[model samples]
Target chain A: MASMTMIPADCSSSTAATTRLLPMSCHKGKALHFSRWVSLSNRLTASSFPSLSFKARASSPLISAKIVIENAAKVIDGKEVAKQIRKEIAVEISRMKDAIGVVPGLAVILVGDRKDSATYVCNKKKACEAVGINSFEVHVPENSTEQELLDSISKFNEDPSVHGILVQLPLPSHMNEEKILNAVGIEKDVDGFHPLNIGRLAMRGREPLFVPCTPKGCIELLHRYGIEIKGKRAVVIGRSNIVGMPAALLLQREDATVTIVHSRTKNPEDIIKQADIVISAVGQANMVRGSWLKPGAVVIDVGINPVEDAESPRGYRLIGDVCYEEAIEVASAVTPVPGGVGPMTIAMLLSNTLSSAKRVHNFR
Target chain B: MASMTMIPADCSSSTAATTRLLPMSCHKGKALHFSRWVSLSNRLTASSFPSLSFKARASSPLISAKIVIENAAKVIDGKEVAKQIRKEIAVEISRMKDAIGVVPGLAVILVGDRKDSATYVCNKKKACEAVGINSFEVHVPENSTEQELLDSISKFNEDPSVHGILVQLPLPSHMNEEKILNAVGIEKDVDGFHPLNIGRLAMRGREPLFVPCTPKGCIELLHRYGIEIKGKRAVVIGRSNIVGMPAALLLQREDATVTIVHSRTKNPEDIIKQADIVISAVGQANMVRGSWLKPGAVVIDVGINPVEDAESPRGYRLIGDVCYEEAIEVASAVTPVPGGVGPMTIAMLLSNTLSSAKRVHNFR
Candidate 1:
C-alpha cells in the first residue's frame, strides 16, 4: 500500500521562516501567482512526485508521501531585496563620490547580436545608472577574432575610471572563453570569473577580491532573509564554474556541510532530501519536486529554464529547476524563477563595482 | 529483543574488492597486528560503536546491530604501491633525460630546525635520489628574516635547472607563510599549494599544473588498486586545504558525488554510512569506527596521529583517523595508517617534479 502523509503547514519550524511573507499584491507575490498559474495549467498532468518521475513512486516509500497544501512557502522577494541593495549601493556610491570626488564605473563588453545577451547587457547598464555608477559599453562583431576581444579587455583593464569589467558570456563559439576571461585584470574582475578568485573562495582564510555576482546574490538573499547557513546541510546541484560551484564554496565558507550533486550523481533525490538547504542550478525545468525536499528546507533556485507555454504570446515561458507548486508546499521558503536570481545578479554587480571603487580610492 | 546479523564475508561485492588482500605476514600485516594489539589492550573497554561514542548506541537502532566479524577488510599496502610508483617515476625520469638531456630538479627550503620538518626533507631528498632526480637543499637559520627566505625562493624560481620548489611548512611564526608560498612561481610549484593551481583544479575542463601530493597519492592508490570512483558516493571526513579539500575535488572530478563532513557537521556518522568510499583526513585518532561504515565501503585513512603509547619505544605510536580494528571488520578494504598514506606523499611529489620538468622541456 502506498502511504500518504500531510505536509505540515507550520513555517515557524524553519530558521528562514522569519522572513515576512510578501503580500500577494506585490511584485514578488505576482511572481508566485504567475509561477503557480503556469505550473497548474501546463504541468498538472505530470506526477506529483516529479523528482521521482524516473522511478516508480510506489517502490520508494520515502518520496511517496503526498503533499497536502495548507500553507505555501514564504516567497523570497529577490526583486524587493535587489531593489533594497541597489539603494544601499547608490548611497555608498554617493558617499564615496562626495568624499573622494570619484564615482564607481562598470564596463561591459557584448559580443555578437544574441537577443538575450543584449537584453542582459541593457539591464546591467540600466542598473549601474540607477545606482549612480558610471557605465561603459562596447559591442564587438560576431566575426571578430579572439585577439580583438582581448584587445577590448586590455583597454578596459588600463582604464582608471573602470572599476569593474564584465564580458557577457557565450561569446561566439569560435572564441576561447578561458583566454578571454583570463584577460581581465583580477583587480577589475567584478564578475569574479577569474580562476584566482575562485581558488581564494575555495580556500579557508583566503578572500576573493570579488565573488561571482549570481552566487553572491544567492548568498545575499539568504542573509537578508535570515536563513541560517552555519552547521546546516547544504546540497548544491550542478557543478558549473559560474553558479553551482561558487555557490557551494560560499555556503561551505559560511560553515554549511555541503554536498555537490552533478550530472553523474546517481540517486540525486536521496541526497537532495538530506539537505537543510537546496540550491539547484542545473538549468532543467521542474527537476526538483516536493518529494525531494526536506521539510522546512530553504530553497534558492538559480536555474532559469524555459518551457513550452502555448497560452502565452511567446511559445515558451521561463521556469526554474524546482517545481513551483510542489516546492512551495514542501519548502519553508522558496525563490521564484523570474524575479528571484535575475534581479539579484545586476544588484550584486553594482555592489561589486562600488566596492572596487572604494578600495581604489581608499574609501571606507 | 536485540537482533544480531552476521556480516557477509563476500569480498566480491565491492568494486574495490578487486585489490588483493595482502598476506598477514607482510609489512601491512604487521601494521594490522600492531593496531589490533594496541586496540585490544587499551581500547577494548570502549564500546564497539566508536563512531557513536558520543551517543547512546542502544538509542539508535541503525547502529545497534551486533557485528559478527567473519572477514577482515583487504589491507591496502600503500608502501608497496608507493614503491611501484617510484619505479614508474624513475623510468619516466630516465626516459625524459635520455630523450631531452634534462634532469628534473627539486629544491627544498627549510627555515626552522623542527625535527619533523628535517626528517621529511631528508626523506624527500632520498626519494629524489632513488628516482634519479637532482635534489637541492637550502637550510636557513630560525632567526632569518622573511626577505632572506623570499630571496632564496626567488633564486630557485629563476633557476633553469629547478623543476620544482618546495618551502617547508610551519616557517618561523614571524614570517608570512602566504607571502613565502606565493613567491614560488606557479610553474615550479610542485606542491600544488598555489591558489591559481588549486583554482584550475577545482574548475571543470581546466587542468592544474600539479595536484597536492597527499591527495594525489590517495587517488593514485585507488587507481592502482582498481577501485571504482565514477558514480560512487564519497564522503571526505575533513576540510583541510591540503588533503581533505583537494581530495574531495579530485573525487568530484572523477565523477563521484562527494560530501565533506567537517567539525561543524552534525550527525557525521549518518553521512558516513551512505558513502561507498570514505576518505578520513581529520587528525583525530580512531574517530571513525565500525558503526560509521557501510558494509562494502572502501576506507582510505589519511590521518597519521600519535596517541600515548607507553608500551612503544618512543612512548607513543601513530594511528590513523579511522579505528583500524573496527574498520577492518566492517569495511571491504581499508588502508592501514603508518604504511598507508605516509609513503605515498613523497612518491607523488617525485612524480609531480618529473612532470614539471617534462612540461618545461617539452618532453613527452
Candidate 2:
C-alpha cells in the first residue's frame, strides 16, 4: 500500500474551544467527528509520499488542481453534502421541537474502553447534539456481564424518551454482539443493523425501518447528487456486514447490478474498472488507485484509517482506504476521507433518531 | 407449460402413479419416495430438447440422460427430489424419537381461507405426517383481531412441545404479514421467512438460524446432486420476499455473484442468459423460456403454478415458472414441476422443525 506524506499539525491555531451542546459532566472535544481537513498546497512534499496533501482541497471558486484533480474530487464531496444534510436535519429538529413537545433522543452504550470505540462514541454524541437531538451516553466497563448489558438494554427499551439505541461496536471480545443487539427492541434499532431490518432491506417489496448507517450514507450521497441508480453496474469492494454487504443490497434495491468484491474475490480492480459506480469500504488504505476507477464513475469511500504523519503533532493523519490522489483524476465524483463518509455516519444517525421519533410519535 | 394427463381414478397402472409417492394417508403400500422412484417415462412432448425432465430417473441402468432421452424430457424433477428429502427427514425423525424421546412438532396457522392456501395447508400437514413430525393445525377467520392472532402466537411460543411455527401465507389483505411473522419469535420461525433471519442471511458475515424453506430446498437439491456453487455467477429472477429475494441472498452467501431480477427490471432474459446458475421464483408459468438459459446452465425453478388443463380431473396441471420444453435442451440440469421444488418446501419445513427443536434444546 502506498503511504502519504505526513502533514504538519496546525495545532497552534486550534485552541481549546468549548462546544456548549455537551453539558454532560464528562466528555472531551468531538472524537469521532471526521477531521479530514486536507488543504491543497505547493507546501506539498513538505507533507510525505505517497503524498495525501491534495486529498481535501477547500471548496473554492477556482477548481484548483485543474489537471491533477479530476475524477476523485469530482466523484463525491461527502463533507459538503453531509454538512448540507445536517443543516436540513437541524431545521427539521427545530420544527419538531417547536411544533410538538418532542425531541429525538439517542441512547448510545460504549462497552469496554477501546480507544477507537471511545472516539467513535464521542463523535456520535457530539454529532447528535449538533442536530438538536438529545443523546444519553452510557459507559460500561470491560468486565461487564451479559446480564448487566442486557439490563441496560431493558432500561433503554422502556425509556420512551429515548427513541433510538446504539451500542458502540467492537464490544469486548467475550461479548456476543448478536445477543446484545437482539436485546434492543426492533422499534428503536435506529442503526438499522438489526437482522429483521436487514432482511426487509435485502428482500424485495419490503423496506427496512432504517438502512444501516454507513451504507445509508452512501445511498444518500447518490440520491442528493441525483445520480440515477437504476440499470447501473455498481461494484462494491469489500463485503463487511456494516458497509460492503449492506451497501451492495442498498444499491441493488435501487436497481443497480451490484457485485460485491471481497478479500477472496479475484481481480478486484478489474471488477471495479467495469463499474459505473464504486463504493470502496475495504479498510485497506490507498488500495484503490486512480486506474481502478473508470472515468466518470461515482465513488463513495467508506474507509477511515490512521496513517503516519511526522509533520502533525499527533504523529499521524487520517486517510481513506482508497488512494484518492490518482482517483480524483479518474472518477467523475468522490468523497474525501475525513469529510466524506465519516461525517455522513453521524448525520445519518441523527436522521435515524429523528426518524425513530417520528415513527414513535406517528408523525407521518 | 405442459398439460397433465390423468388415468382413471382406479387405473393405478399408469407410469406417474406407479412412480410417484402416494400421500402419507394413503401409504398403506410400500412406496418409493421422490428420489428412489424410477422414472418409467418422462416424455410427454416432442423430443427436440435435451437435458430436462420432470423427475429424476432412479434406475441404475439409466445413469445418464441419453441424447435421445434428453431430447425428449422437458422437466426438472422437483417432486422426486422433494420426495427423497422427506424420506430422509422421516428416517432422521424416527431416529431422534427412538433415541431422545423427542418428536419435532410443527404448528401451522391459517387465517381466512383461500382455496389455494387451504390446499397448501393440507399438503404441509400430510408432508409432516409422512416425515414422522407431529403437526398442529389452527384456523382463524378473516375477521380475527391482530391481538387474537398474537395471543395464539404467544400460546404457541410458550408451548414447550411446539418446536416450529408456520403461518400459511397469503393471509387476508387486512392482516399485517410483517407484524404477524415478526411475532413468530426467531427461534420458532421454521419457515425461515422471519425478517430477522432473512436479514442475517443477507448480511455477509451473518448467517440466519434457518434459511427460508423453498430456497433451502433449492440448495439441498444442488448439494444432493453435487453441483458446484462457489465462484459461480448465479442469476435469480423475481424479488418477492417469500422466494426470489431470500433465494438470491442465500445463493450470494454461498459465494455466487448473484444478480437479482425483479418485476421492475428490464431485459431480464438477457440478464438470466449470462448465469452459470439460474433460480426463477417469479411464479409466472413459462415466463422463463428455454432460450433465456445459457447452455449447460443449472436451473432451479421454485414456481409451482396451476395452469388450466381441460384433460385432467382437477381441470388444472401443475407447472413451473420455467418453459420446461425449451429449457431442457439448453440447461445442463433443471428442476421439474409437480415433483420439483414443491416437494422440497415441505421437506425443508420438516427439517427446520427438527432444527428448531435442536436449537431450543441446545442440542449439539
Candidate 3:
C-alpha cells in the first residue's frame, strides 16, 4: 500500500477571511495559518489523493479497493446498484415517452468554462443519453450578462422538451449565481440546487422534485452500500447549502443525529472522529485523515479536487477531501473518489431529469 | 437531578439508533411529523402527541421563569424588551395612521372548536390591542370546506390594511395544510412558517422577511443576551420545520456546527450532551435533562407541553422539553418555559406583523 504521501500537515487550509471572519484557532491549537480554501467560485481542491481513492497504500494490497469491494459486496454493490437505478429510470422515461410522446429532457447550461464543470456537464449529457432521455447543452461565453443567462433560462423554462434544467455551477463571477440559478423555474430545477427546490427539500411533508445531485449521490451510495442512516451519529464536514446542508437534512430526515462542521467549527477533526459515518464535503484535499475517521465508519467523500501530479499526463489528478490511504485502512467501507460520489451525482441528475419530465408530462 | 425516563426501552437514543439514522432522520423526520401533525384535520391518531403549549407553566416556580429572567438581564429584560418593541410598533402604527391613514391589521382565522385555540386567539387579540394594531378574528365551524378556507385566505390576501394574515395552525382535520398555508400569499405570511419562508430561511444570500416566530424568538433571546452564535456547536433537538428546522438553519447561517436529533436518532441524549448550545423543540415535556446538556451550554427549550398538575387550578401545568429544574443548575444560561420562550413567541409574532407591514408600506 502506497502510504498516503498526503498527510494532515499537507493542508493548512487558509483561514476563513470572509463574513464574520471568526478565529477558531482557539478550538484546536493556535497555529493561525489562514486558509484560502474558499474561492470566488471553485471548490475542487485535491489532486494528489486521486490514486489513493482505490488503493490506500501503493504498497499495501491488503488495503486496496479490490478487497474493500469484496467486503462491501455482503452489503452493497455500487455499480450493480447504480445500474438497477438507471434501469428503473430508463423504464420510467420510456413509459413517459410512450404515454405522452415526451422523452424526458434535461437541458444543461454551462457558462464559462471551468474544466470540472465541463467534465460534469459532459457526464450529465452522457448519462441522459444512456437513460434514453433527451439532453440539450448551451455553452455561453464566460462574460455573459445576468440578463442573457436569464434569457437562456427562460427559453428552457418554456421549452416543453426541457423537463429539468441545470446550470453548471460556479458561473462566471460577473454573473450573479443566485439570480441565474433562481431563474430556472422550480418545475424544471433538476439540480435541486434552486432555493425553491431547496426550501421544499428542507421543509417537512413537502417533497422536493429534485434533491441536490451531490447529496443525492451520497445517499444513494449509502443506500446501495447498506449503510444505515437512521439512528446514527453522522458528521458532515462542510456547510455549503448544495451538499453539506441538504446532506445533513437528508440524514436527519432518516433519524440520524447530523452535525455540520465547517471552517468555523471547533475541533473539526475531533468531531469527525465521533461519527459512525463521516462525510467529508470540504473541498480541501486530504483534510479528513484516517485518524479523523472513527474505526469501521462509512466514509463518503464528495470532494473531487485536482492536485499537482507531475507523473500524470494531465499534470494533475482528482482526489477527495478525505485522505483515502488512511481512510481505507480505518474505515470498514468507503467510497472511492472518482468512481464513488462522482458517478452517483451524474446518475441522480439523470434520475431527477427523468422525474421532472414525468411530472411535467403528467405521466404517472 | 431528576432521572430522565427513556421513551422506548429498545431505542438506544444513545448509540445504536444514532449510527443508523444520522442521514435520513432530519429531512424525513420533520416532514413526516409535520404531515402527521397537520393530517389530524383528516384523522386523529393515538400516536400523536398533545398540542398543549409551553406557556401554561408560568405559574410553576419549579419551571424557574424568574431565574431565566434574572440571567437574561445582561441580554434582555423580556418584559421591558417586549414593551419597548410594542412601543416602537405602536409609534410606527400611529405614524402610519396619521400620514397615510393606514394601520397594520392582522386577521386570524380559527377553524374547528378547540378551546386552546380560542384562548390563544384571545391572547393574540389582547396583544394586538396592546400594540395598537387592528385585530380581526373569524371563527368557523369544524366542517368547513377546503374551498371556504381557501376563499378566506384569498380574501385576506387582497385586503389592504390587513398586512399580515395568520391562519391559526393545527387547522381542522379536513384541511390540506400545504394548500391552505400556500394560499396565504407569501407577503402576508407573517408567521414565516410557510414553506417558501422556510426555504428562504434555509438558503444563504436569501433572507426571509419573517422568520417563523418561535425560532425567531429564540434567536432574539440569544441576540438580546449577547450570545455569539458564530462557530458554535449548536444542537437542535426535534426536527419540526416550524421550530427545529428553522432554528438549525438560523444557527448554521450564524456558522454553528449544527446537529439535529429526533425520535429515531440513536443515543440522542448522548449526542446532545456534546453541544455548546442546545435548542430543544421536540414538544416532549422534560425530554432534555441536565445530563444531556453540556456543563455550561445555553439551553433554549421550545416545547410547551401541558402536564397533569393538581396544584394548579387549571389542573395542568406547561413544561418545556428541557427540565428547567435541572438545566439551570447545570447550564450557564437557559430559557424557562413560561416567561422564557413563551413571551418571546407572541412578541416575535407581533414584531413580524409590524415587519410585514413595514415591508408592505416601505416604512423602514
Candidate 4:
C-alpha cells in the first residue's frame, strides 16, 4: 500500500467556511454530531492537492527522489475483464444457436444526426457482431417526425427476430423522450431505461426484467474482482438516473449500506470518506482528490471528461472524475480512465440482450 | 415535551450482548461507533420498562408520588389530522362536482374472504363516500382463476369514470399478483404498486403518478407536523415492498440522508441511533424501543401488530413496532399505534383518488 499524505489545514479553510455557512443544526449531545462534523470538515476543506507545489519542484532532485518511495495501487483492468465477459457471452450465444436455431438480436434506433450518437450506434453494432448476436439498425433523418421514430419502434416491437431494443438517448428537442422510450416493448427494453425496469431495480424482492447497462457493468466489475459488497459501506456520488441512482439501488440490493451524494449533499466528502467502496459518476474532471478517499477504498470512476492536450494529435485527452495520480497513492485499487467502465457498458448491453433472447426462446 | 427517565443499564445487557455478537467493524475511529453503539445498546438491552415494579408500587403512596415528576410527550393526534384532510378533500370534491358535473370515482377489486381484507375494503369504501367520491367494488371468489380477475381489471381499466383503481393485496395462492397489478392502467393505479410508479418515485426528476399510500401517509404526517426532512439523517427499518423500501426512497427524494436496515443488516441498533428521524415499518411488535431513538428524534411507527390483552372483549389490542410507553419519554413527539399511520393510509388513498380525477379532467 502506498503511504497516505495529509493535506495542510490552510488548503481546506475555504470549504470549512462554506460548510459552516450552510443551514444545518446539530441537536442534542455535541459529542456525536460535533466530532463527526469536525472530522468531515477536516476532510472537505481542501479543493485540490495540498502538495501540488510539485509543479515548482519539477526540476529539483530531492522532489524527484521522494516520488520513488511510494508503490502504485493495483489497476482494476476493466478492458480485460470486459473482454472475458464478452467471451463468455459468445459461448452462450453459440450454445443457444445450436440448441434452438435462434440468434440473440439487438435493434438500435438512432433518431438524430449527432456525431457522438452515430459513433455509439456503430460501436454497439460491432459489439453485437463480435458476440455472434444479430444487430439491426434504423436511422431517421435529423428533421424526422416523432411519429416516424415511433413507427420504427413499433416495427421492432413486432419483429420476432429482435430480442432487445435500444433507443439512443437525447431524442430530437421536439420529441418527448419518455414517450419514445416507453413505446419500446418492456420485454425488449435492453437498455432498461423504461420506468418499469427502474422501479423493479429500486424495489426489494422484485427482480427487474433488465438492469440498466452502465450501472450493471459497475457491479459486474466489482463482482469479477472478488470484492465483498455485503455489509460494506458504499457511496455513490452523483444521482443521475442512467448511472448513479441505479448504482446506489444495486449496491443496497447487495446488502451494502449505501448513501447517495448529489449536488444537495451538505458535506459530500465527509460522507464519501466513510465508504469501503466509492463509485463516482459525476462528469466533472478530476473532482475527487486523494484526500477525499478512505485509505484502501476501491474506486470506480465513470466520468470521461475531455481536457485540452496540445501534445496529442486530437488536441484532447479523456480523464476520469478522480485525480488519477493522487488516487493511485490513496486507494488500494482503481479503474483507469479510458479502459474502465467504458468497455463494460457495451458488455452489459450484450449480456442483457443474451438474457432477453434466452427468456423469449425458453433457452437456458 | 415529556420529562425523560433513564432506565437501568442492566435492563439492556442482553440486547447489547446480541448486538456485540453480530459482526460489525468501523475501520478507523471506534469512538464514534462505540458511542453510537452504547446509545442503541442501552435502548435494546431493556425488554420492558425498568420500573415494572408497578404492581408493588400501587399500594405505596410514596412510590406513586415519584410518578408526578415525569411529563407526557405531545401526542400527534392522527385522528384529528385525518379529519382535517378529509374536510379539505370534501370541499375540493364539491367544488369539482359543481363546476364540472363529474365526481371522482375509485374502483377496488378485492379477492378472497379474509376478514382483515374485508374490513380494509369496507374502510376504503366508507372513506370514498365521506369525501363524496364514487365507489365501485368487485369481489372475486377465493378460488377464481387468474383470467377471471384479469377480466374484472380490464372492465375497470376501460371505465372512463374510474379515476383510481386499487386491487386489495394477498390474492389467492394460485394467482400471480404481479400480473394482476400490472394489468391496472398506470394512470388509474391509485395504490402506486406498479413498477413504473415505483420507478418514477425512485428516480430524481421523474414524478410518480401516485405515491404508495402507507409511505405517502408517513411523509404527509411529517409535513403536517412541520418536521424538516432535508439534510436530516433518517433510518428506515425493514425493506418490505409495500412500506419500508418505498419509505426510504421517499425520504431520499425529500433529501434526507437515508439508510435502510433490514434483516441482513448487522448492528441495526447502532445504525438507527444516529437518525434524527426514524421510520420503522418492520412487522415485529416492540422491535424499536426508547433507547434506540436519539433524544429529540421524531418517530413514525408504521407497524400495527396485535398482541393479546385478556381484559378487552376482543381479546387483543393493536400496538406499534415501537414500545410506545417508553418512546413517549425518549422522543420529542411520537405517533400512537391505532391512530397514527392507520388513519393516514386511508387519507392518502382519498388524496390520490382526488389527484387522479383532477389530472384526468384537466382540473387544477
Best by TM-score: 1
lDDT per model vs. reference: 0.80, 0.72, 0.71, 0.77
Q: For each of the candidates, what fraction of the native contacts does it recover? A: 0.72, 0.59, 0.79, 0.61
Q: Write the per-residue lDDT of candidate 4 for residues B154-269, one digit (tens) a residue.
A: 99899999999999987889998888998999999999999999999988778999999999999887777667789888889988778998998899999988878887777777
Candidate 1 lDDT, tens digit per residue, A1-364? 0111222222333223322223335434545554554333322221222222223323343334332222345667677778778877888888888888998999999999988889899989988888899999999999999999999999999999999999998889999899999999999999999999998998887889999999999998888766788999999999999999899999999999999999999999999999988999987777787778987788999988766667669666777878766676567778988888888988999999988988888889
DockQ of every candidate structure: 0.65, 0.35, 0.54, 0.46
Model 4 per-residue lDDT at A41: 30
DockQ-better candidate, 2 vs 4: 4
Which should have the higher TM-score, number 1 or number 2? 1
Q: Over 4 Å off in model 2, which ranges?
A: A1-73, A204-207, A267-274, A289-295, A306-318, A321-326, B1-76, B142-154, B204-207, B306-316, B362-364
Query: Which residue segments of model 4 deviate by more than 4 Å?
Result: A1-73, B1-74, B308-313
Candidate ranking (DockQ, best to worst): 1, 3, 4, 2
Q: Residue A65 error for model 4, in Å?
A: 13
Write model 3 residue lDDT over A1-364, tens digit each, in one string. Answer: 1122332223333322211111233211211110122112122222201222323324355444444333221111234445667887888878776776778888889998688788878988887898898889999888878888899889999998788888888878788787788888988888887776777888878888789988987887776544677888899988777888888878877778888889988888888988878787877777787667766677888887777677779676777788665565566666665556766777788888877876766678
Model 1, span B85-184: residue lDDT tens = 8988999988988887899999999998988889889989999999999999999999999999999999999999999999988788999988888899
Position A72, candidate 2: lDDT? 23
**Can you write out model 2's per-residue Cα lDDT over A217-291, one digit (the tens) per residue?**
998877766667888878888877788888988988888877777765556677688677889887766777766
- The clash count of every prediction, one per candidate, is 0, 33, 65, 5
Q: List pairs with backbone clashes in candidate 4.
A: A12-A45, A12-A46, B12-B45, B12-B46, B43-B291
DockQ of 3: 0.54
